[model samples]
Target: MPRFAANLSMMFTEVPFMERFAAAAQAGFQAVEFLFPYDYPPATIREQLDKYGLTLALFNTSPGEVNAGEWGRSVLPGREQEAREDIDLALEYALALGCEQVHVMAGVVPQDADPEACRATFISNLRYAAERFAPHGKRVLVEALSPGVKPGYLFASQYQALAIVDEVDRANVFLQLDTFHAQKVDGNLSHLIREYAGRYVHVQVASLPDRNEPDDGEINYPWLFQLFDAVGYRGWIGCEYHPRTTTAAGLGWLAAWR
Candidate 1:
């Protein structure tokens, strides 16, 4: 069976962030992931992980100026310095928390931005991040955000993300496939799983259209879980979804997997 990680960012919103660690452990999750951990000290987050005996699966670098509509600086030209700073900060947190993977966000493209320039900037920034994290035994991840949810984002297709990984050409850099985004952009998910089985380093899941629990989605998650096992995908599958009702109430989908 595939190991599932509770995404604290989208799951368990009934309690505060810190308390969600215990909630996840109580719910029988062995690992957890979140969007960003810059709001709290790394040591504090580590304490909760140790207390609950949970492994920190993954997290992303800070999205620069979220309110200003900036998802990241890596894909924005002339922001190489800021991107490096973001990478360094994320490395600090990953080492402190004992995490093995970090997602490097590709910022949204400006209305007047050149697509080629943005792609080049993204490749360069990813190469830099990979080099930096390689020495510490860490991996760098790049994800494709759906254009509908994040309009003008760098890329929305898994092919685009895979191409970026190829261009970066670094062993440490890999794709982070989110099923929700993949289903939104490209619907043949089964083909994607089989075709890119060993290419991606992490996987995230949620229902299509509603972005709810995986149990009722158009995607057959139970079969996908079996496929993941067959393909030798030994990585954490993040539960990055909003519940139909309460988080705890909607977790019946996880019981069979547990």
Candidate 2:
């Protein structure tokens, strides 16, 4: 069976950030993940995990200046220093929380910025991050966001992300595939699962058109779940979607797995 992780950042909005850990555990999740945990000290979050016996599946490196419309810095040219800082900070939290995977966000590309230059910068930054995290036996991930969600995002397709990963040539750097974006940008879901079975380190899911629970989506998650097992994908499938109703109520789809 495929393991699932509750994305606290999106789910469990009924409570505060710290309280979501307990809510996830109470909902029968063995592992959990969130977008950014920088708001709270690692020890504090670690306490909740320890208390609830939940494992930290994955989290992202800090996105630079959200207010300024920057989603990430790794893909931004002339911002290598900031990218390095983000990686270093992420490493600190990963070690403290005993997490094994970290998603390195590829920032938005300025309209006037040269695409090739941004690609080169992203490659360099990914290599640096991979090297930094490899020593600790952690994996680095790169994800493709749909243009509708993040316009001008570095790359909006899994193939593009794979190409960049190939160029980086780092063993620890891998793709972080999201079903929502994949369905939006590239439809052949089954083909993708079979083609890149072991290449991706993490997976996320949500309903297309609405980005809600996986129970109702254009992409059949039930079939995909079986496909994941068939292809030997031993990574956590993160629940990275908005709950149409309460998170717990919408989690009926997870009943069998639980």
Candidate 3:
């Protein structure tokens, strides 16, 4: 069976943020992930993980001013310093929490922004993050966001994310293949797994359109899970989805899978 990580940010919202760790463990999850860990002290998060014996799968670099509609800032031109700072901060937290990977979120691009400039900035910042994380036995990951859902997001396709990872030219920098975004932008899910599994170090999933639990999505996750095993990807597949009902109630799909 594939190893799965519960996304605390999206999966266990029924409880308080700090309390989700135990909930995930009680749900029989051996690993967990979330969007950002900056809200609480690193030691506090670590306590939850130690208490539950759950591995930290992945979390994103700090997204600047999320309330201002900023999904990420790394890809925005002139924000390289801020992006680098975000990397350092994430590294600090990751070290303290024993997490081995961090996702570099590509912030939304303005309509008038130059695509080339954004790409260059993202590539440069990614290289910086990868270099900084490599010494600690950690990795930097980049993901392709679905275009319509997060308008103006820099990486809207797997190809784009792959190209950026290639350009970054760091062995520790890997693509975060978010299946929900892949289903939205690239439909050949099996072929994608076969061809690009080597490029990914982490994976996330949610049903398309609604971003719900994996069972009812257009993409058949069981087949994808088998394909992932066939392709030799032994990494954690994160359950990053919004619950249709209470978080615990919505976990029937995962329970059935288990």
lDDT of 2 by residue, 146-223 (tens): 999999999999999999999999999999999899999998999999999888989999998899999886889999
* Candidate 1 wrongly placed segments (more than 4 Å): none
Model 1 deviation from the true structure expressed as Cα RMSD, one decimal place:
0.7
lDDT of 1 at 237: 99
TM-score of 2: 0.99
C-alpha lDDT of candidate 1 relative to the true structure: 0.94
- Give the alpha carbon lDDT tens digit for every residue of 91-200 in model 1: 99999999999999999998899989999998999999999999999999999999888999999999999999999999999889999999999888888998998899
Worst 10 residues of 3 by lDDT: 249-258
Model 3 steric clash pairs:
72-107
The whole-model lDDT of each prediction reads: 0.94, 0.94, 0.90
Tally clashing residue pairs in candidate 2. 0
Per-residue alpha-carbon lDDT of candidate 3 for residues 96-214, written as tens digits (9 for 90 to 100): 99999999888988788998898898888988898899999999999998877888898789988898888899999998999999888988988888998789989999887799988
Ten residues in a row with the worst lDDT in model 1? 215-224
Per-candidate TM-score against the hidden true structure: 0.99, 0.99, 0.97
